[model samples]
Target: MSQFLRSSSIHEILAFFGDLEKTRLQSISRMFYDKIIPSSLQQCFLSLLTKDKFFSYSKEQGDILYYYDIPTRTWIDVKAANHQEHYIYYSMSAVVTDLNRVLLIGGSFDPEFEQYTDAVYDWNQITNRIQPLSNVPFVSFDNGFFYYRGYVYIIEGHVDLFNQSTVRKTARFNVLGNYWQTLPSLNHANGKFNMCAFKNGFIYAFCEQMSSFYRLNSNLLGFERSTNWDLQYIQWERILIKPSVYFGFKMAVFGLNDNQILLFGGDDEFNNQITHSPISKEFSDANALKILDLTDLSLHKIVDDANQDLKIELPDMFYFNQLSEYNGKIYALGKDHIHIINLSKKEIEIIKDDGDYNEEDY
Candidate 1:
């Protein structure tokens, strides 16, 4: 016995689709595709935004480094540096590693002291608090920090701030151990310096007299220099030049959202030969900050150029130093101005008031 079933013809199918409303047909097709196809393929059909994450940047209420959750858009002030007996300084600059570990390095909060930096604080995201370490690190600044070999390696620029002569070579704090270990001293007595981190474990130390780039090997002890990256700058009115010399010595070094590394305003000894003053006379009067792209090794200065749509007001006297990126936006803490740059929009927004810190009054 043969079984017979009604088979829909091509004409019937075309007639059914032609008779359906546009919206109804679209809805039906979507539903059918979603039900029939696997999620991996169906996901390709949907459009997605650029995934702009949002985060907040705020000074600590008392004296502590804070972490803001990008997903939930919430701030968690880690009160890890508060002193119960005597209120000590809580100065910090943090780096989030590959494993998502936040390492808030040492700095001074109190301005009364000349030279003194407390212990390095490690805040584990798993625990949501500051983690304790066995070894205590000596005082240092963000100028001496670079992430290498899954560890935060530190270069002790100046041991004594008052002395200004005591040179403490270099060291590293194992993010895993939370301990401090010293590395080999620099080639010379470089008490003040700035380091730029690059791809393939390359770290560039840019200073006044000398600038050198090195590759941090897997052992962490192995450091090989690539070439002598000479430091110099010529003030041009409107020409584009690559910045080989780092102007921002103590300021912020940022990898921009637009795939560029921004070196903000920093102080350094004068290298220009055009100065009429004594040869020994060191000048820090140059206020022009630089923005360099590592991809093509191209450099551009942050100026009042009509071509570039800068969103924030550039700092005047105060050196804009520290850089921190949150929620796809870059926030810069100058000596006076707190600048927030929206990378996606290519616009800059400035926050004038800094709580208690005064640049001019000081």
Candidate 2:
């Protein structure tokens, strides 16, 4: 097609679909579908942009997939549809598998969503499609997903007041049996301020109460608190700039081979914006990602030149949350894009296109 016709055709198609009915909508949607999508897909494609529940992850083939709105319609490289699935309210949560499958935990969005999520799916790495796995009684979102000890851990919670309490609930999923099992109550259940797991048989949690910090033993059936890193024993050093907000997201702790934990990006009690609700008084903006050496409690910023390279304005919104070490390079996933941190070269490169960075170089 010529440029003029191609441009005009899209405009005409948009206009036609703008006033389409359900039957016509599906027909037109199907015509545009380059791939087959099941009719069981509940959520529509356009609604995904509005909802934050969709999952985003990079595949083994170096393709970025956004499993959004509808299960059967997957977005490739954050663009239009490239693949599809047949599910709804799936935990946009993404985890890597030994064979390289993308595990997604989904749940019903009913009242149960706050208390329970009973669905899970595994997206095959070879075909770029998703299949149901097992279900959990606790919803995935209520408790964030963390992979440790060959199983995915789901933490549960309920918010009562705007900024006051985020009650901690708990559950675990067995990858082998595909079932949900309850765990002991969190020692500090005020609300999950932020949490991450380390390979060193421990999961660390910091709360919004500002009174306690916890180190949960990974081996214990229930998350048993390790009293060594509790609140009263914490040593605080003076900082020129205090991280004022929680960033409403979990702080990521990366475990290095040298028995050191890299603590990066967490909110101090001063910033309330980190909480899930803006209606609450505890909302503030945090944009800095700090690296704390667990060995000596030494602190440093991940990006030395924030203004020049990082360009981070909102510490809470656009910060590194997930770090994966593949092929000797560390790939950090931030809010907007992925950064390839060359620890060897002490440099950073933003991954915009799938073809831009060769996987072999990692």
Candidate 3:
């Protein structure tokens, strides 16, 4: 209220206000919401104008929760109405939670990973429901959540399925106290990885038929009243590079700052072939866009002509699973559409599919 706009009795009531008295001062500022403003400063200014756009999950539908719109590039179904059934999207692990909700994690329903799932689904886009909070003391699958700074890092995945083994179990969720701490494991455990997060909270993991590139140290996520884990040194830095490509499953590496990194698509060996395909010019130097440089940790290749894999044209190369970027566009996703990309004038668009996606049966 800034003392009712610096009172001279509101400067003699804004000389009779205006715009219909600014719509009656916004209905008298909603009757001074909780008396002179204080609903946690309207949730701390709507979480500082939060802009995650959308990322809902939970096999969406079976337990309702869709969210993926970013300006009519649809996926709708914020049909909350409170739903939940162990948010199973197999081998579950989705994260967009810091209170902007949508958190499903750790899943498995018999692909013989031995009936896993330490359930923990959230959703709640204003009660378009899917709740069931704590229960993942352990259970893995292609894991990787890492929500940095506000803490939520799950990390470790690939838990034994005929030896895709890996278990230094990591899990440190605390989304404003929905508690689930314990994150200091993984000295190089294996199985489908990819955890990028950088600049000041470093994390650059790597898995899937491993080739070494671990790092994970940024005071190892400190929090004992502001960092001081015995003078900090939380480990994991196997960056002893060796092999070459194919990593962190269903591929698409991220982090474009703190010394670049951008990889894409998987399978330089996972079903044995089919990793680079802007339109299947096949392998095109392993998906023409691999950067990974952490200042000499080398792994370059940037094929000019704006990534000419036949001058880019991907409606669906399975959309390349995931490859974030935001605000400067890079998306990629799949199972329906979204190829956005822009990587600076090397354009690409393809966001179609308004038939309200529930697809994927091929």
Candidate 4:
């Protein structure tokens, strides 16, 4: 047995054990492996092993990548090996693949150059390397981006820098094939909207500028690689429900269930009046929470059983750029904090980054 354990390949050893035994042996192997490996390498390996973690990349913070450990309740910085190869990326979109890699999509690398990028990068969590993938067909920023199944979708966004004009274009990139395909365009042209995918294989997009809620049934699209699918036949159904005008560009929207979605926190316009300054009193509604019911097409604010309004405010540094979900909670990634939404409890817990660079209970 000892000779077999020492001589066999990792695949052979893994295949020989049952599921429960494999897990037990993995835990034991990690315990012994940690003693010999460097702390940096151990962090990278542990990140891949742990499933319940949130990876956050903020262009505002330059090339540093951070991840929140749900079990330990800490945010640790995972330094990139080739962070200096690219400049700071702003208004970019990121999605974690099934292979445990983070893919960063289109965004502007430098404001001075006014250059928007079509470049996509594949960031490996284990090797801590950021490598360039195929470039997107078009350059845009602040687009509605999300990952579903094995593909990443990029929705309408600003096409140019000076004019601030948006396009109705939408596209999807095959993660495994490393290729892009243009999908059907949206009915409206808008940027900075909230987008999410449901378990029923429908992609939902909500744009406050157009006051439009649209969804596409991906299952009917037949996007397999072998098929010569004509995208023009595909259509996005514009939902009839008119969302509140206050649900502005920065609001975070996430799926609650098959027939429900939860939206909160954004630049709120009070009385149909827009506030110009970022520091204006009515600039943001950080505590507003609403649930959209698709069954009856009703939009209503969520309240507790006592008929009391639930007041949960996002942290001051919270950015609604991208969100991740694990278990039953939705993790809203921010510049220095992560706001966790507990669906069952209707509560929000903040994981704040102290000056020491560690996330703690707030």
What's the TM-score of every candidate structure? Answer: 0.54, 0.53, 0.29, 0.71
Worst 10 residues of 1 by lDDT: 47-56
- Over the stretch 250-338, how does candidate 2's per-residue lDDT look in tens digits? 44445555455544443342344334323222333233344545555454555543343232233322121356555455555544445
Model 2, position 93, has a per-residue lDDT of 51
Q: How many residue pairs clash in each candidate?
A: 4, 23, 7, 0
Quote the positional error of residue 305 for candidate 1 in Å. 5.3
Per residue, candidate 3 scores C-alpha lDDT tens digits across 1-362 of: 76744433433333233324434444565667447444533452343233334454535345555656554456765556754344335545455532244576655354334455666677655655666678777775556665654556666655454554444566666655567776666755444554444443566665544456676665646564332333246766676544455432355566766788776554343433222212222433344556678778887655557455322243233211345556777665654556666766766677664433344521
The TM-score measured for candidate 3 stands at 0.29
lDDT of 4 by residue, 1-362 (tens): 85434423332333233335534644667668555433453343334434566666645455677666676767678777776544666555567654345887765465566565677788777687777788787765456777665678877654343454434677788876688887766765443444554546677776544345778877766666643455566678876644333455445677666888876655442224332213222334444577878887677777766776554464332333456566777777654556777767877787765322222311
lDDT by residue (tens digit), candidate 1, 154-190: 6554324445553445556665445666554444433
Considering only N, C-alpha and C atoms within 3 Å, which residue pairs clash in candidate 1? 252-321, 311-347, 311-348, 312-348
User: Which candidate comes out best when scored by lDDT?
Assistant: 4
Deviation in Å, model 2, residue 157 alpha carbon: 5.9
Selected candidate, larger lDDT, 3 vs 4: 4
Q: Model 3 segments beyond 4 Å from truth?
A: 1-64, 67-78, 82-121, 124-128, 131-151, 154-177, 180-202, 205-215, 218-228, 235-261, 264-288, 293-296, 302-331, 334-337, 340-362
Q: Supply the global lDDT for candidate 2.
A: 0.43
Arranged by lDDT, best first? 4, 3, 2, 1
**Clashes in model 3: which pairs?**
18-21, 80-128, 80-129, 81-128, 82-129, 83-129, 193-248
